[model samples]
Target: MATDVTVPTDLWEGDLEAVITNWLASDGQAVKQGALLAEIMVEKSQFEVTAPADGTLTITQAADAIVRKGDTIGRIG
Candidate 1:
């Protein structure tokens, strides 16, 4: 089974979208649960996205992609 890595809906308060700034884990890389996986920027503020489970990462959204809250950016399986 795969777990979806999503941007938390409560990460920020507003309707403004965020952009994926960097991917800390490469595609297909094995990651532990709670490991930092990516960075996102909302205006000048930056946030870290963490792995939801221990598995191989599969990026669904690339760096520089604009994403909204609750968007699934990757999967772990």
Candidate 2:
């Protein structure tokens, strides 16, 4: 089964959407749980997205893509 990589709903306090700044792990790459997977920016603040479980990463959203809190940006299987 694949684990959904969602943006944390409490990452920020505002309603402004975030932008995927960079993907630290490439698609299909093996990763461990809690590993940093991507970077996201909201307004002027930046945040890190981590792996939900140990598995191969599958990116569903690319860098520079706009995203909101709780949005699924990738998966791990």
Candidate 3:
């Protein structure tokens, strides 16, 4: 089973959406749990998204895509 990688709702203030800056890991690449997977930007603040489990990365949202809290950005399979 794959684990969903969603935007963290409590990482920032307000109801602003974040832009995916880039993906640190490539699609189908093996990633360990807690590994940095991507970067997101909201206004001037940036946040790092990490892998939830040890598995292959499958990105659902590409770089530069806008995402909100609770949105599934990728999966760890």
lDDT of 1 by residue, 1-77 (tens): 99999998888898889999999999999999999999999999999999999999999999999999999999999
Model 1 RMSD in angstroms: 0.6
Model 2, total clashes: 0
lDDT of 2 by residue, 1-77 (tens): 99999999888898888999999999999999999999999988999999999999999999999999999999999
Q: Ten residues in a row with the worst lDDT in model 2?
A: 8-17
lDDT of 3 by residue, 6-73 (tens): 99898999899899998999999999999999999999799999999999999999999999998999
lDDT scores in order? 0.96, 0.96, 0.95
- On lDDT, the stronger of 1 and 3 is 1
Residue runs of model 2 more than 4 Å from their true location after superposition: none
Residue 59, model 1: lDDT of 100
TM-score for all models, in order of appearance: 0.97, 0.97, 0.97
Clashing pairs in 1: none
True lDDT of residue 17, candidate 2 = 89
Question: What lDDT does model 2 reach?
Answer: 0.96
Error of 1 at 22 (Å): 0.3
